[model samples]
Target: MSLIAWSLPKKTQLPAVSLLGNLFVLWFAPYAFVAMSISACLVYLISHAKSQKGHWVLLGVGYCISQFLLLRFLQEHSVDLGLGGSFSVLGVAYFTCRDVHYLVESYKGNVRKNIVTFWYYQSFLPVMIAGPINRYHEFEREIQRRSLDFDQISKGIERIIYGYAKVTVLGNYLIEHKIQSYLTQLPNQESILHSWLVSLADWAYLYAQFSGWSDVAIGFSLCIGIKVSENFNRPLSSKSLVDFWKRWHISLSSWCKDYVFTPALLITRNLFIAISLSMVTMGLWHESSLYYIFWGIYHAIGITLCRLYMKQDNEIVEYLRQRFWWSSFTRALTIFYLINASVFIGLFYDGLY
Candidate 1:
């Protein structure tokens, strides 16, 4: 797909290429294509609505209903739908977010209403499945400025190779096969050490898997002369939960911050409520289950505590901040907090005694 896009002479042909590629990919799952098309049309119409406030409410309700139905279907059927198991439910989670972003930005008068550009943004093959959730404006700008550059193509190829290595070698072989297998074989599976090990391995595998897909998406976009936002940045090295969110799944976090947190904060005028709503929304976006809700709440509590701690004016805090080892200590503490939180949740879901 990237090669085909790169070979096109006219920049105007880019969206067409994307459409073709998207159609081909969606051919096996026509329902997804139809659903996404309807969503795109609705967003377009809502963008041009007379009352911005009413349209915004409608968009919110529609988004929630659609997501709920999609998730319910996914959970009930566990349908692969096609794409050779590369994605389930045909990337509805991702493209739906993109559509909402467009609708919101359109409401804010930031995006121009062009169906072609909006469709292109929704179905762009590179970031279609696993996304950095490229914004419409950024994508349009890239489309306008794109050109076939050899250097960019070479770097893109390198990134793709690195991404596949992370997915297959690090995520699949080393972590899932070797480390997880060894951990599972331990004599005491319920031991603290075993749980922690399992959690750590799970976290590592998730990062490699997600970041690897992001890398591939970004690489493919680069190959087609478009640069997308990055999704991860050494999240495990973060010194606090707040810092970790800033570094982890950056696009989604920022989206939630902008769309969910800010709006909830303004409407409710409460910090805890806003943060909890945002985090829970993000968690539910991953999977609509009790486990994810608790996961979100756990992070919300961590973030709230971090914020409160930052508001303190104590000498001990100042002294710790000045220490050279403080950063390392906090980094380790943050990672430990996250791993154990996951372990706890896993145990709870698995019926802890």
Candidate 2:
């Protein structure tokens, strides 16, 4: 294979790392990760995939495939895997395509400038993974996005450190001490609360792992040259389950709202029917799994109830807000309710398989 030396001004370029840098940080072997990233990126490019949801599904599948090949088929000698190496393959492939999508949106009217500058911004690595799901129009403004200012830097570092501490300390304790033992021990079918208590640790562990990484990514983006979208908020603070969803995985919620819910709602005047269809769409979108269906149903019921409850006389939402002051007691109660409900739903349906 021939490699070409790229020449571009640092000012004009989107902030991303080199192939060699990707190799160093992101793959089982630099070569292997590079190959996987190339293949995955090619897959999206050739497919001309438009939606972020599609990209996420494809990336998840690609990661699974690469892991199977590297860990199952190939020996350790065949590849030395680092977390970034595997993550990079999935991450780079995703962001590369998203940047392209955003650029296309950015240059809706100017075809000439759009084509010329498309590749430059698209290949920038910062926005490529765990994205804000850019629309090309907005990205035109940030073509040569710069590093954070002092205030941004300070806040970003604090957020990153907080994220790291959450994952490393609290998240680690749950995983290493609680989750492991619980997973090995068979569920006591007699008392559901036993299962609920154990699984809550797993959920917290998952949140810490993912949120911690997301914070680090956000901090890294600021340290470099671009500001990406926020991923999560304090979801458990939600008054209702629907509100909880809005706070929790913002990207996925938005995707579902935009692509599935709104479209379905538009098609029919019947609220129940629209919701029913929306939930089914969400289930299939999550991958055609039984568990996803259950989750979708759970969400549909929750959303529907929330809507219906709001329409009733003396709305529960207004009552709750007016009744309870936002205090540690209320917040803890909200957390308790959400976690307890989620635990049963989670165990009742573990994996798609």
lDDT of 1 by residue, 1-353 (tens): 67677666675567667778578657755666667777777777778777768657466648744764675566457766564533335677777778778777877789886777777787788888786988888889998888878999889989999998999999999999999998878898778988788889999999999999999989988988899999999898798999999999999999899889999999999999999999998998887778888898888998999999889879999999999899898889899889988877777778933
Residue-level error in angstroms, candidate 1, position 166: 0.3
lDDT of 2 by residue, 217-265 (tens): 6765565445666778877566665666677767556655654566567
Candidate 1 residue pairs in backbone clash: none
C-alpha lDDT of all candidate models, in order: 0.82, 0.54
Best by TM-score: 1
Local error of candidate 2 at residue 15 (angstroms): 6.2
At residue 83, give the lDDT of candidate 2.
Answer: 36
C-alpha root-mean-square deviation, candidate 2: 7.9
TM-scores, all models, native as reference = 0.92, 0.64
